[model samples]
Target chain A: MSASRHRLGRLIGNAVLLAAVATTLAPLLWMLVTSLRPKQDVFDGALPSALTFDNFSAVLHSVDIGRQLLNSVIFAGGVTLGQLAIGIPAAYAFSQSRGRWSRWAFAVLLLTMSVPFVVVYLPNYILLSEVGLLDSHAGMILPQVASAYGIFLLRQHFQAFPRAIVEAARIDGASEWMVLWRVVVPASRSAISALAIFVFISTWNEYVWPQLVAGAPGMQTLSVGVAAFASEEAGTQWGSIMAAATIACLPTVAAFLALRRQIFNVLLEGAVKG
Target chain B: MAPALLLFGAFVLWPIARTGWLSLHDWNLVSPDREFVGLDNYSELLGDPDFHRLLGRTLMYVAIGLVGGFLLPVGLAMLTLRHAGRATGVYQTLLFVPTVITTAVGALVWQFMYLPSGGPVNELLDTVGISPVNWLKDPSTALPAVGVVGAWQNLGFSYMIALAGLSAVSPTLLEAAELDGASGWQLLRHVVLPLLMPTLLFLATTAVLHALPNVFVAIEILTSGGPAGSSSNLLYDVYSNGLRFFRVGEASAEAVVLMALIGGAAVWQMRLIERGVTYER
Candidate 1:
């Protein structure tokens, strides 16, 4: 009797889970279908009987999606590259610093880890505008690159890094820079790429920051581009908005699928420790 | 060290201090005229009913999000943990793919889906022998609908956390419980749940923070905090006020208020979690 009961429970569990998976994916499936159908047929269920790329072409040609795509890459890629460049060095120095001042500074920096950037966005906007970076990609990337959490996370990972390895590299006649590049970097590539994936994905999805700073159509990220399309086209141009959203989501989705392991590692680490 | 210190001082620390200073002034962000107003913006905010409603709604969204957010992910975690087969990988990917979608895109997708007429959701409802509901149009239903999207977007992150918590749990404890004739329910209740407290606390705190600031993309895109501003949160207000209206002083004041609230909550979380976590071993 117990064995039968357990089997029933397992069966019920599987059915419920599969249903949830379908529910969660239904919207995306609908979006893809809607993006393909012509304007008249968008509301007609999950699959399009007829498929066309006219909506995609309209967004690209009339809506200026190509310009926005370039801006998004520049902004998100710039931030990703900049954060890695600065964050890795800062993290290394922070991990190796054996001094009182650095420790005090590190403690002070930790306070900002959970402080959401939204709080400082206004002032930062003002500063960026003052520096003539408003409506520019520099404005978009510069403010985001200095991440306290990045340093904090990397510091933890670096702490776990074996020190004997570094000492052995030093004994092998490698300079500090060479040791960092040839030895430490190769070892911590996973953590570094994980950080890159996060910064890039989040930046790609970033709406408010780019909205505030790069509101100009030529300079905004894909998110702002799609949002502009939605706000204007939501009522009458449903198919186009669907197409634009698909365009905005495609890259991040591709990245996530391609770099699945790295993204999962970062997200999993954040869930556990953060 | 110099680069990090310079960047942090220029951006994070200084922006905070400047925001504090800007809160005390009457600057319209463009004009050269800067008049000092002591505590006026904050005082105005305190008396403003709309600001109060914004705060209340933000708290409500977080509260409502927690209701489904905690239960759903925890349930998913347990369900996923029950089996260790290859199908688990496919299920995990399907559930997690939403997390990769841009929040703006996610919001747009849901906004489209929630259309009152000719929307797929309405069609599904009609087929299920229930009349269609205006998910985002009605004020009473709007916030919860928006909250559902947030919960969906975050479900994967939360599920991953719970799975980690489950796996980290000692297998010997489970075996011992089973050996003592403890059923599945009892094993989860007595053995697994207690060990999962830290994960819950972390989840709770993040759920609140995510609702406040991180949810703006959805709210901005979907409703624009509309249907009589039913879905506007504090951060959305900050964005709409300062950035949209160029009301620098008022927006900066709101930012400061939000920062203080977040700081206080973080301290509370540390205390709450540290007490339990310190003695766990």
Candidate 2:
């Protein structure tokens, strides 16, 4: 009787866990299902009777989706590249420096991370407008490239890096730049790559900055463009909106699937330590 | 270091300082002229009933987020600990799918789900012989509906953190507790929760802090804080007033208030950690 009770408990546990999974995925599943059916049949049921690529075609034809997607790539890619280019050296400096000064600097960086983007967005917008960068890709990418979070993450990895490797490279008369590139970077490739993937995915998912800055049709990122389309179409045209959402979601979701292990590792480390 | 500081100073430090200054003046975006308005905006905000309602709604969102985002995932993570196996990896991967997806796109999909007429959510409700409720259109439900989208997106992150914490709870301790005749539920409550307290505290603090900002995209896309600003939060107010309406000074004031509230939250979190709630063993 006790053994059966334990089995019953296991059954209930599996049931609850599966329900959580179903609840989490039901919306995405609905999105794909609705995108396949005809627009008029969206309300028919959960499952589509027949599938078609017509909605995808209609979404592609209706807007300059290609341009928006290209913009997203450039925006996310630029921010990622720019962040690594700047954040690596900054993290190295923080890691190598000694004294209360570095501690103070790190404290300031931590404080900056906690300041919500909404707090500074107004002044940043005004600054961008003053510089004639508003509604431009530069405007969206420039302010975001300096991420305290990235610098903080990289700094943690750099702090734990082996000091002997750096000293050996220094003894060989390597310049600071050379040491960074040839020694430190190659040694910490995994961490750096993890940061890159994260920065890229997050920048791709950014909405408010792109929506606020990219007023021009040509400069809007994929997420922003899809959002505009979704809000404009609202309750009517469910098929096209779902198709746009599916298209917008595909890149990051695909990336997550491919890089799940690395992503999970970074998230686990960051969560436990931070 | 120099380049990073330069960029941070330009974008973050300068902008924050500028926002503080801008809050003390009255300047519409189009106007070339600026008038000094010391504390008037603050006083007005304090007096305004709408602003109070926005703050209350913002707190409501935080409460919902605490339950849905933090507590639910943490509880689920603990449950999965009992059924740990190869399939745990699959559950982790699938649950985290929403975290990687675009919030704007996810909100759009939920917009479809919450449609009043024969939407999937309503269809499921109808199968149980219940009447349809207008999810997004009704003022009472709009804020919670938008808040849930943020909670959903946040689930994977919180779940991963909780799972890591649970796994860190030493197996030897569990075995010892079981040897002491503790039942499964007793072991969970007496052994695991205390060991997991630090992680739980961190998750709680982040849930409160992230609630407002996380919901901003949903509010913008799903409802635009609609049905007469019923769903608007503090961040959305800052966006609409500053960017949309171009009331730069007033918006900056709102922004300043938001920063103070966030700063206060962080300080409280630090105090909570310093109070020694973490279990040594």
- The DockQ values of the predictions, listed in order, are 0.61, 0.67
**lDDT per residue as tens, model 2, A68-91:** 989999999999999999999999
| Regions of model 1 farther than 4 Å from truth | A98-100, A170-175, B129-132, B171-190, B270-281
* Top model number, lDDT: 2
Give model 2's TM-score versus the native structure: 0.95
Where model 2 places Cα greater than 4 Å from the true spot, the runs are A1-3, B171-191, B268-281
Q: After superposition, how far is residue A17 of candidate 2 from its true place, in Å?
A: 1.1
CAPRI category for model 2: medium
Candidate 1 residue A138 Cα shift, in angstroms, is: 1.3
Tens-digit lDDT string for candidate 1 (B1-281): 68888888998999999988989988888899999999999999999998889899988887866765566777776766664335766777788888888888898889888889987878888998878889887888888788888777877776666666665667557545544563867876877678767767766776666666656677877777878989777777877788778888898899888888888877776666556542211
TM-score of chain B of each: 0.87, 0.90
Candidate 1 per-residue C-alpha lDDT over A213-238 given as tens digits, one digit per residue, 9 for 90 to 100: 89987887788888887887746788
RMSD to native, candidate 2: 2.4
lDDT of 2 by residue, B199-231 (tens): 788778978887887888889887888889999
